[model samples]
Every structure is written in C-alpha cells, then in structure tokens.
Target chain A: MTDDEVIHMEHVWTRFGENLVHRDISLSLGRGQILGVVGASGCGKTVLMREMIGLQTPTQGQVWLLGESLAEADARRKQQLRNRCGVLFQGGALFSALSVFDNIAFPLRELKTLDEELIARLVCMKLAMVGLGETDALLMPAELSGGMVKRAALARALIMEPEVLFLDEPTSGLDPVLGEEFVGLLGQLHRELGFTVVMVTHDLDTLSDLCTCVAVLAGQQLVSYGTLDDAIACAHPFARDFFHGKRAQRILGRSD
Target chain B: MLASQSSAETSALPPLSPPEFAVEDGTAVVHGHWNLRGLIAASPDLRERLCRAARRPDLEWDLRGVNVLDSAGAFVLWQAWGERLPERISLRHEQQSAFRRWQTGGIPAVRDGRRPPVPIRRRIIAAIAGLGSHLLAVLALLGQLILDLAHLARHPADIPWREISATIHETGGRALGITALVGFLIGVVVSYLSSLQLKTFGAQVYIVNILGMSIIRELGPLLAAILVAGRSGSSMTARIGVMRVTQELDALAAMGISQSLRLILPKVVALVVALPLLVVWTDVVALAGGAVSAHLELEIGYHQFFQKLPAAVPVANFAIGLGKAAVFGLFVALIACHYGLRIEPNTESLGNETTNSVVVSITLVILIDAVFAILFRGVGIR
Candidate 1:
C-alpha cells in the first residue's frame, strides 16, 4: 500500500532556542490522500510545515520530500522539490505588491522558463481552476475580497499543479458558510487534481465534512488519527465530546 | 422565523426591494440602504443580482450610501466590481466601515496585519558589515589606481590636462575658504592657550612651536575628520538605513545584488581618500592664523614665527597625523555602514540607529585617536 511516499519525516526533532517545539515526530504522507492536522493555536502546526518546506532544519532527524532527503539535496534539487510542493500560508499571504495574476505567476516564473504568452495562459487557467477567472487576474492583492484572496492563494498554490499542497488554517477568519465553501473547494481540487493535501486547521466542521483522515496533536504527539467514524467510536471522553460537537450540526442541519 | 410568528407576521417585516445599481464614466454607483440587522437577515438574491450588474467590464465601485453589509453583503459587492477596482474606491458613509470588518480589496477600517517581519538576520549581519566597509574601500582605491595605471600605460594622451585642472579646482581651490575659517579658529585657540601657560615661564616664543606642531600632527586632522563625519557620515547612515527599512535592501537581495558593493563601497572609498588632503589643507590655514595670532598678541613677528616653525615640526608629524586621519575615516565609514545595514524595518529602529551611529562613530574616532597617539609615540614618529 506504499503509493510512493511524497513526504517522510523519520524521528524529526525541532527546537527553537531551548524549547523543543516538535520532538521525535515521524510522519509519512502518501501521494493521493488528504491529511488533516487539527490543533489549537501555537501547537507547532506552522513549524511542522516549515520543516516540510525545507525552510527550517530539524535538530536531529531526517526528512524526505519526493524521495530525496531535503538536507542532502543540492540547490537545484531543493528548488525543484519546493516548486513541486505548494504552500498556502495562513492569512492568505499573497504578495501585496503583485497583481493577482502575477501572484499566481510567481511560482511559475520562478520555476519555468516560459514566454509571456504561455505564462499568461497558465496564470488564467490556474485562476479559473479556483473559480476565479481572467477578470480577477489583474487586480492587486489589496483589491480582492477575503474569499477572493483565499481563492487567489489557492490558485497560486496550484499554479505549478504541485504534487503536494500544504494549507495552514485556510478557513480561520471566514464565516461558517464561506468557511464551508472553502473546504468544499479544497475537496473538489483534491478530487480533481489528485494532489496530496495536508491541511492544518482546528475547525470541527472541516474535520467532519472535508477530512478523509483526522489527526489530533495533543500531549506532544498525534493523540488520535483515523477515519471520522472510527475515531468517534473510540471510548475516550475528549473524543466523545469532539464527535458529539460535530454530530450536533449534521443531524440537526441547523446553523444555530 | 420566530416560534410565535405567523406567515403574515413574518411577511410584514417588509418585502425586500429590488437591487439598484448603476455605472457611469468608470464609476460604479451601487444604491442600497439597509439597517444593520435587516441586511444580516435579508436574502442573497437581491445582493447577487445587484453585484452582477455592477461587475462591469470597465467600472469601479462607488459604495457611497451602503447602509450595512455582512460577509455575504461584502462578497456580493466585491463580485460586482469584477474585482478590478483600485484601492481608491471607498464607501462614503461611516456605517460602511462596519461592513468592511471582514472584507478585503479595499481600505479596511482596521489595519491589515500582514507586514513582513524585519529579519533579525540584519542585526547578525552588523559584525561582518564593519569589515565589509574597510575591504570595499581598499578594493575601490586599488581599482581606481589600477585603472589610472592602465590608462597611463595604454594611452597617456587620453588623460586630459583640462580634466586634472578642473579636479584640482574643485577639490583644493573650491574647498580653501571653509578650510581656512575652521583652521583659523583652531589656531587662535591653541595660540591663546599657549600664551596663557607660557607667560609664567617667559617662554612665549615656544607658543609658535606648540601651534605649528599640534595643528600639523593632530588637531588639524582630528578636527577636519570630526566635522566631515558629522556632516557626511550621519547623512550616509540615515539614507542607507531608511532605504534598508523600506525593503530596498530586500529588493536588492531579490535582484541578486550586493547591497554593500552598490551602497557602502563608494562612500567608504570617498571619505578615506579625501581625509588626508583635507588634513593637509587644514594644517596650512591653521599655521597662517597661528602666525597672525603670535604677531598681534604674543609680540612675536609673523616672520619670526615662520622661521622657527620648520625646525619645530619635522616631516614625521605630518605623516603621523595624515595616517591617523585615514584610520579615523575608515572607522567613521565602517561604523556608519554597520549601523545602516543593521536597521530594522520601522521608523523607531531608523531613528534609534541613526542617533546610535553618530554617537558610536564619534566615540570610536576619539578612542582610535588615543590608540594612534600610543602607536606613533612607540614608533618614535611623534
């Protein structure tokens, strides 16, 4: 069942100053699965993503992205892996100076040596994939709505049609409706594009609806990670409460 | 609907009106006014239809009288604008500010908290930045000398005499008046002090020796360098530091450029090369004033003062003084570059570093002067 492990971290340890934020963590992400990491604020979700993206080095462990250890990879190989893995930072960290088109085109430009005509075509196509079209391309980051910014960030992440997509709190500030829609979009992209998705969020609604497998970070380890029904069936007080909170919405089908 | 509310009662709340929208001369005029709670409860159809009309191929939003909008309301208007409006489009009423709470693409009432962090890497960079300045100055001077030698070796005729004359006029002749004024005041102070102390010993003739030796060996170079550092070094730091904070340094890095080569190298080279010449100019003027002061106050004639001066100050004094000035110039440039590149991206950091740079540079200059004094005395050059 090993479908070409896209990301593998064996006994990873990350320490900031004197505090060990992530310790002896081993995680493997397969090619076409959605992995959801659920944790409260400051639970080292972003730190984990940083290690995956090769922005931070682990204290003492190994990390492999696309079959190559990130530490041992040459500059060209590292860049190639980075291009292959797209990251959507929390707060939709779109470069404010660039137009929406250029924001999506940033990775494309950085990676591919394409002419302007080809770049424009690719940028438009990516925007359209995120339910944004050619009309939304020329607007700057400051000119897009929150929903649009999220969409643009998504488009930017998918511009290279990356093998893996990492989204950090993609639905933090959004309302229930928009948040649900954003999750739905993530689901659609995953199904259609078949890119491995690893999302870090704390929304219970997202966990129940969108996630195929859920992992909870508590007590300094993944306390629970399984299919929603399987995890709910576990006889733990915290797990029971978490499942009940999610069940209240689906059975009642009420906004309240 | 509320639990007790009947169909008629719920309907009586008020049937929603049609969405009103208009576009004229690149300006979008969306006309809708709903109270806070009403829009929150209203259907999305009217909002969506209105947005579709406003979302013109070539138009901007003019949300002048928007009464209230939730996330849904904001999204509708945003969609209508076809998302092409520049940030200049704004809502006129105060109530609209409330609507912008969760919106994007326009001026939000609360500020966006998306500014990139001022990288701590810059502070870590300051140690190397000092050495960078010195190395750059030496490199620039070597480069210029090499180019001059190359020209002379290749085709000496290309070195125009007119250009050399112009350079002298700008560097020496144009600078003479200010240099004389500064040097003369220093000379008067030295002469006046020597006269005060020497009247006890009846050795006022030695006042000429004191003025000549001190001005040539130390005071002239130190004073000139301090003045220039105050005038130019502070300015260079402020300019570079401001640029650094404004993301100009980041821009340069992104462009794959060496900010030190582009910014630090030139200023360091100019100051180090110019300091010795300014010292020599200051020495000449200070001596002129010393002769005038001796003649008027000490009863030693100008001719007598000049006659004794050559014997009092050896060639070693001039050499030691110029050498000290060169070192001081290097110190000023290094400190300025260090502080400039160390600037964090905020006005507070800019102001603090600017003040710190000036104070630090001057203190280092004085400390360096003490070191020079010790070294020169040890070498028997003083």
Candidate 2:
C-alpha cells in the first residue's frame, strides 16, 4: 500500500455465479487525484468504486482505505469512513419526498453536530457551489429539472465535506452544455476542496479536459492505467477504439 | 458408446465427445465424470428425457447409478416434480448413503415450504425477537415523548395547541363515528345471543348484566382496536413504505434526523392519546345498543337496563379496558410503521407486508388481551 493512497484494491476479483465481472484487478488512488475509469456497459467500473466505499466486498481480494483494511472496520469505523467518502449515484438518487434543503442537510445532520443556522448556511453554500440558487432549496426532487437534480444530489454528497467523492455516471442524462457545466463545477470543487475524485463514465470527451489519470477496463481487468497522455500514447486496441470512437469492427478489421 | 456408429453414419454430428450413452436392448446407459457445470449444461436434454420416461403414473426417479450430485443438480431433479413437471415424479432411493445424506441435512439450497415462509418454529422465535425490538423502540419513543411532554408541561407558553388539536381531530375525531358504529353492532350481537340462553332459564334480567359486562370489559375496546388496525394501521404502513421506497428515509438518515423521533413517535403518541377516548365512546354506544336490544327481545324495561348497567360494570372496568386499548394502539402503530419502513424495492413485498401488519397487529392485540386478563384477574381488578 502506498502511503499517500486514499484507495487501494489489491488483486480484486468479483463474480456473480457463473459470470466473472472482474478478475485479479488492482488499482490505487492517491490523495487529491482524479481517476477517470472508462469502459463499456458490462465491464465492471461501478463495482470497483463501490468496493472503495465499502459498499461491496470483493470475492477474492482486499480493499484498503487510508491505510486501514475495510474488511476489518467495525460498524462505527465503517460509518465514519463512509462519511468521509461521499457518493453521487448514477441516476441522481435524491430522496423524492424531501425538499432540496433537506437533501443537502442530510449528511450534516447524520454525521455532524451543527446548529440549525450553521446547517442552513452550509446547505446554501453547497447548493450555490453547484450553481443552484438559494431559492432552489425548498423545491422537492420531482420539481427540479434533470441538471438541477444532479446539482442537488452533488450538494447532498458533499454536505459532510468529505475527503473523497465517488461519482457514477455524473453526466449520464444531461445534454452536452449542462454536462460540461457539471464537469466545470466538479473542477472548481476539486480546486477548492483538494479532495480525490473518482468518476466512472463512458464519456471519453471528459478524459482530456477533466481527468488527470485514466484507466481503461476491458477483458475483466484494468488493461491500461496511467495518465491520460499515457493512455493516448498506448497502442491497445480497446483504448484506441474507446478514445477515438472507433467501432470494434473498424479496429479489428472484421465484425464479430 | 454410440459415437463410433453415429460417426460412420454422419460426419456432421459433432463427434459426441467422450461422455456418451449407448442404447442396448432398448435401455440407455451413460458414463463419465459428473460435475455440476457439465450436468447443468445438459439440463435441457435431461429434462426432456426425464419427462418422457417419467410420463407413467407414480413415476420413480432411479438415481441408483448416479455417482455424485451438488445442491443445484439435486434441486433440479427434486423440484421438477412439484415445480415444473407436475405429475407423480417421486424420488426413490434404495442406496443407504444417499438416503442418509438426504435425511441428514446435506441439502444446502432447499426452498422453504411456506409460501411466504414465516415458519411456525422460526416465526415463534422471530415473534419473540420482534416483540423485544418493538419494546425497545417503544421505550425509546416513550422516553422522548415524556421528555417533550415534560418540557411542554414546564413551559406551557411554547405549546402549539391549535396544531396539536388539528392533528388529534385528523387522527382520532374523524374515526370516532365509525368506531362507535362497530361497537354498537358488537353490543347488539352480544345482547341478542345472551337473550337466547337467558329466556330458557327464565333469567331475562341477567341479560342486562351479561351485555353490560362483556361490552364494557371486553368487546368495546377490542372491536374498535381491530377496526383501527385495519384502517389506520394499514395507512401508517403504506405511508412509511412509500417514503422508504422513495429514499426519504435515506434522506432522513443523511440529515441526521432520527426517523423514530421524526416520523413514528408523534403518530404513536397521537394514537395513544386517542385510543382511550375512543374506547370510552365505543363502550357508551355499545351499552345503549344493548339496552335497546334487551328492551325489544327480552321484554326487559329500559329503566331496569339503565339501573343495573352501572352496578354490573364498575368504573374500574372502563379504566382497565382503556389501559388495554392504550397497549393495543401502541402495538398497532409500531408494527405497521416497522413493516412499512422495512419494505424492500419490490411492490409485492409492500402489498404482502401491509396485509401482514394488520394480521400481526390484530393477533398480538388478542394475545395481549389474554395476558392482561390473567394479570387483571390475578390482581382482583376484574
């Protein structure tokens, strides 16, 4: 395990009955570093980050977080570590019954002991950080548009002021203009908070602009992992096809 | 092996690999290493062949020559009769070791026999555990309620009486008329049934005593509680389940709000406050209906029924019945909320649990009534 690493997956293998989704895969995330995991739909990038947050246990391997093995963490320790690692789910998993203010105030209420006034102020700040106005706080989840809901969800995830954030398909349903805006907001949040960000996305255009490091998942392994420049410089067919939007048939010179 | 003969006949037949079965004298015999994956791969063919051979009435699965089987393969053969094939495909075992393994709990993945699988033995244990968990949750909520009420008692100026009154009206007052009607019908039934036996003994006056005692002591509170359990209990559960499915509970968890305090405690407190009043109302209406029935059928005078009613059911009877109502109300509210909040993502679970909450609440109410009867009788309070 590296000293500065926030996440470490050593020889991780995950399986679902007869299907093996990941096999002997290993990767690490250093402090304040952003790792963009790019893969096709069934390649198991989401499961890797889920392991990092201790949401899933590897079938055959170990997951270590901040120098402590997650396998051995007690409930209290696990809760604390989970509070430190915030997650924004793929479909903007906001609580539909709660107003945006309650959504943003949830993590603070769960893990911190702050006065109501302070919680209100912090909620507004977090909301404003995501480009959602103060007036948007009282609206329920169903009332918001797709982009606004994502912003609200992001605000909720960051309520604890976590040291690391996991975003799954952050730009999944948004148009390009709003998707790029969300990425820019993430960039600003990273610049200000200096927290490590791990994003699992199929959107390859995000790699050059936002991600510092990229890992391409194929054949149930992290086939190539390094800086974006390294990924571009590599000659693997999967990475080449993914980054350039080359169809599998064009790259392989034959259709399957 | 039939592979050599078939290979000569057709070149395109994919050469039947190593594990082959040969037909000799109209009987097929197979031999090879049998692993779970290989057996699963040939399941379609095995199922077709088994169905054809086992079409006879009272079929027996002859696994005498089978070497080894895993849980999946065993279940496929075992479950095919009831689950898939539906005819008489009984599993017959002449081997001692295999029979012993089957009897001695070698099976790992057998489905529970109960449709919803609330096993009698396990449900008894779960009931005890569920009771303990409910008691703990109640104690915690009651402690908070006590603290809040104490604070309100200390500073009456901060109390929101209008809001409290509105909530009470919504939860209790609106339900009062229906509760009274149900109690009145129960009282009429009790009086009518008692008059039947009392007329033969020429003890018609005692019909007044029976109706007054049963309604005030037992049926009034019990019937009203069952009705509420069906109505409000189900409503409470559905409300919580919808909130849970929508991730409102997750939001509450995130915001650091104790869901028990925010959602359950207030509703429980409301029902607790309302149930005793409802029992009192129901008792009055039921006794009036009993008096009407007694006057009509038994030829007992209205004045006589009224005069003997107070003496028959003492004030202590009403008090004890109200206490039962309080406990029953708490059980109904807690069970409904618990099951509702525990709903998984499936809609089937929601529907089933809503029904289960009503059944469990009513069953517990009756069981607790029996225990209370023993306790009250022991204390000479009856």
For model 2 the local lDDT of residue A114 reads 40
Tens-digit per-residue lDDT, B1-382, candidate 2:
2233223423332122222233344343433222233342353456455445434445434443444433223433433333343242223342332223333432222121112446699989998997798678656656766676676689777555564465457667988889878878878888888998999999998886788778877888898788888888888888889898789999998998767655776567677777777888998899888888888898888888998877766777777889999998888877887778767644656788899889989998999899989888844234
Which segments of model 1 are wrong by more than 4 Å? A1-3, A233-241, A246-256, B1-382
For each candidate, the alpha-carbon lDDT, in order, equals 0.68, 0.71
Q: Candidate 1's residue-wise lDDT over B36-136, tens digit each?
A: 22333345465566556554455566777554433334444544555344454666555354334323333211112123455788866876896686467
Best by DockQ: 2
Q: Which parts of model 2 have CA positions greater than 4 angstroms off?
A: A233-237, A246-256, B1-382
Report how far off residue B355 is in candidate 1 (Å): 17
- Candidate 1's TM-score reads 0.43
Q: Model 1: clashing residue pairs?
A: A142-B105, A143-B105, B55-B80
> What DockQ does each prediction reach against the true complex?
0.01, 0.02
Worst 10 residues of 2 chain B by lDDT: B106-115
Worst 10 residues of 1 chain B by lDDT: B105-114
